[model samples]
Target chain A: MMCYIYDGSFEGLLTAIYETYYRKEHPNKILSITDYEKSFLYKDVFIDTDPNKSDKVYNSIKTKISNQTLKHVFHAFVSENEDSGTWIYNYLRLGWKVGKKLDLHLTDDRVLAIHNITRKVSREIHYMQGLLRFRKIKNDVFYAPFEPQFNIVGLLASHFANRMSDQNWIIHDVKRDIGVLYNQEEWVITNINLKGDITFAEDEEFYQKLWKEYFKNIAIKNRINPKLQKSNMPMKYWKYLIEKN
Target chain B: MEILDKLKILADAAKYDVSCSSSGSSRKNKKGGLGNSHISGICHSWSDDGRCISLLKILFTNYCIYDCAYCVNRSSNDIPRAMFSPEEMVNLTVNFYRRNYIEGLFLSSAIYKSPSYTMELLLKTVKTLREKNFNGYIHLKAIPGADLNIMREAGKHVDRMSVNIELPSNNGLKLLAPQKSKEHIIKPMGLISSKIVENVSERKLYKNSDKFVPAGQSTQLIVGATPDKDLNILTLSESLYERFNLKRVYYSAYVPVSKHPNLPQISTPPLLREHRLYQADWLLRFYGFKSQELLDSKNPNFDIHFDPKCNWAIRNLHLFPVEINRADYEMLLRIPGIGIKSAKKIISARRVGPINYDNLKKIGAVLKRAKYFITCQGKYYGETKFNEDNIKNSLLANSSDKLNITQGEQLSLFSLYPNLLPLPDILTKITGEL
Candidate 1:
């Protein structure tokens, strides 16, 4: 009975998985250091994040099990679910035994657990890609502030980078206090804080007013269903949406 | 007029044209490009009426030369008119795209001077967006009777082009819209359809050949406007998909905005019927069901209680109780509750091991609807006996009444402003169908 703990970073989780294999210890639980609580039932082992070890495990999963399973692991890590660490650890344990045929075993509870979390993460990414409303701020930069359920700021960088290739933009995850900043050519994720005071560029309020007006008139007044609207764009996401606000 | 006033009148006028999808084109961003098109189409917002606002759907102008009885923008109607200059349209599209407020522009218009002249302005707007290195999705409405050379040239600049065949049947068209001949509408559709076919082969030969309507063509048909049956609409849509290779056919419920002698005087839009038609459309495109299979001369309308697939399955009870593990992919799709995603999951899961009743749910099968139609591991899980009436009753007992036909009628436009409605001749349009 061993409990493995690592830092909250994705690389740290992979390094923890590597330790379980190298030390030949069966993990009773795998958790991040932030999620760990004192328990007398098992001995805790703090696994330090080593890039070399993490890369080795990452490449092995891509080659041994399948590239798709590797993506599932990464997405599960990004989901930030409380039990995601344990689920990914168990899923990989089974995936290592079955090799490339692991994803076909959908009925397996561990595989299903990992698959479900990955779906949640990807679904949030897709939703945020659409729901993120950018406001023009100083310096002709497009700034969007959102509070997504999952840590998906990094995942959205490449998408917006390719879509808005000629403009400078910043996608801020307000809850996480991190942003993906994109120049004309490339993007990088870094810590940022707006402190809730954002100066709108000239004509920004005009366009926002126009958008709100368009939103109101575009709906078929004959078919006003708040339930359907709430289902598609939930109430929680209305905090930062320009039209909703 | 100010831009704000123009946007309001134009967007309000264009709301009835209900094709807002910005999908199917994967135009990549070139060097120094401002935007790119998403293949799956991203919806930026849902309007209060619960429809997706993907593209910035608006009309180039709301002025028309021909009067149509079913249209709000009929030349005879006393509505506010507005038009966007080519530069104004280009500015709105770029700013909206940059702000992530929309995927692209769904540019439609009422015919102003003439068809060819109107199309030329629409073409100029899209061309300016392209010249500015904007790679975002652009859906341009091809004015029917527009010159073929202008329409063909417009196709090369836009992602998709559509000429609305608003009325489903030619007879309906003649009676409701006297000016629009069926030939005038079909001619442009045929030209655009053939050019899209030509572009496919040309692209194969020269990779750099510009794509023509790369997202493919789509059209909208207003339901409940005329006395056209679901059979006529479905059959017409089937031919459009087969002949023109249309990517989609949108069905909008007729929202009564004008009092016309030929149009129906319904108090509310037939939302439930429109929903059922869309469901049936999905079946024809993806579920492999033909129009003739869903309806016959005896039954020209869908059941108000059951969906098209469930209704079909009940009438043909011999096809029920399909063995889940042994059923082919197409047969799995034929079952009431199994969809394309679930069918694919079943096939992939069966390769690993045989599926049972428990695994069917995790594979995404809706057991409440599928239980009566399938058997897992040779075991039946349905509550009722293996008969048509029993199965339908059991299914009905478990179903929710959310999509009741009588719903959505209480909140009518006439209900809000009682003084504005013409109530005396309401009986002139009720055939008691649908």
Candidate 2:
């Protein structure tokens, strides 16, 4: 049995995928370097990431299969699920045969696996877009820190970049120890380790107090349903919510 | 008063006006704008009532000149009064918006001094937001009896506008809110509708033309406040959708906040009835069901035991046993427990291959109720006979465990029956889809 392993970066995974197609080898598992364990039973192949090979694979997925399929593969890769690499490999192999009709084959198990993972990632992206609370910090930069289940800081930053075009902002995925730093012009995802307490700007407490007051008063006393509130805004997300605190 | 005290009073007063959606507008970010509106709305948080906290829903003021019997802020009731200056309101919106506490502002107001005066105040606040390049979603209230020119100008500055037709029936309006006339409310709605139509065509001719209420308009109707039946309300809603082309009609259950001779002396809000109305409203908008078909003179209210679609399907059993694969999208939508989402999935899945019972479930169809109404490849899955009574009993047995209603008790022959079933109170939480 052969096992393919690469660095956890998206481009490294794409490069490994290109090699599998080029070499015509069906590996048992495709894993990231961090997730890979040393095994004597299977021959391990460490893939070196080549930008040219990865770009070829990226363009082929876009031009041959579909743009949406590319999005699925990228999102599923970033989901950080252990089996996601194998799922994306199988999905793209099938997608290469079916072309743009790949998503329509929802009944196929290989397609369904990718579909479910992408859906989970996209759901987190949508939720983080709304639930992320930004605190005004020193130098007028709006800083929002969240511990989302999926590694979706890049997607969330893009959404906010368009919505808040004039302001400088940073969205930190605290769990992953990475963040997207956005100036007025553009955004870039980079490794960031934030420690200690963040100092908030002046009047931050005033607005937060007002928001808490509004959140408290807006609920009808007669229609208080804590169960419903918990379901919609689950306990996992309450750690950083200003109103929940 | 300080901003903290004023926010508490104004937000408490504004809680009853439940038009909670921040959707339908796609105002993009400008070169140097503070915010932009998403095409699909986002909910920031859910309150204790499980309602979406999409916007910073607050009233410009709690002071009112008119005394409406159903209102907490009515003049006769001496509630704590407060108001926000235009600059104060703008600052709160910008600061709240920057901190991601809200999508935008929902600036509603009680009739302070006069309708025109209140309308001008709303216009001023939104105009300042626009001037600051704040492109966030703004849902402004159009004060009835306000000057047309001011309201028209206000429409250009906000993403959406709404006028609450508080009572469904004109008689209910006259008896409870005597100060408000039917024409005063309807006139602004009519004007906004026409202006939206005008804006659409103008933008088509000139791409850079100014947008008027780009998210369109919506309205709220208070349920259980007056003796208005579901039929009247649904009919009014249908016409509002057809004639005015409004985006949505929100139904807020009367919470019994005030004491009045005209109001029902109920301790609790009629949440179940409100839930049924919302279900029926969904049928009208998406399921291709009509107001007349859902109810008539013979049956004016929904059955408390079953949802509207299930109740309608049981009443008309002849339409059941619909072939799952062969049925068109419209017929698929009429089946019980098959929502618009599931119906669309079935259609798309059919193109790939023939679907079985398992495939239907995987497609997100609620087969618990749909199993009775549909057939898979010429075989019916329902255990009971195809007759209305058998299927109805089976469905009752299925739902009675959840609702805690007595299983075998016969429904009363009288039309106006009490809410015997004690469904959970969370059922009244207004879903964001509406």
Report the CAPRI category for model 1: medium
Q: Native contacts retained per candidate?
A: 0.77, 0.81
Worst 10 residues of 2 chain A by lDDT: A100-109
lDDT of each: 0.87, 0.88
The number of the candidate with the highest DockQ is 2
Residue range B176-255, candidate 1, lDDT tens digits: 89999999989989998999999999999999998999999998988877777888899999999999999888887778
* Chain A TM per candidate, in order of listing: 0.97, 0.96
Report RMSD (Å) for each prediction in the order shown.
4.8, 2.4
Best by TM-score: 2
What is the CA-based DockQ of model 2?
0.81
Model 2 Cα displacement at A41 (Å)? 5.9
Best by lDDT: 2
Per-residue lDDT of model 1, residues A47-162, tens digit only:
99999999999999999999999889989998888799999999999999989999999888999999888988887887787889999998899999899988889999999999
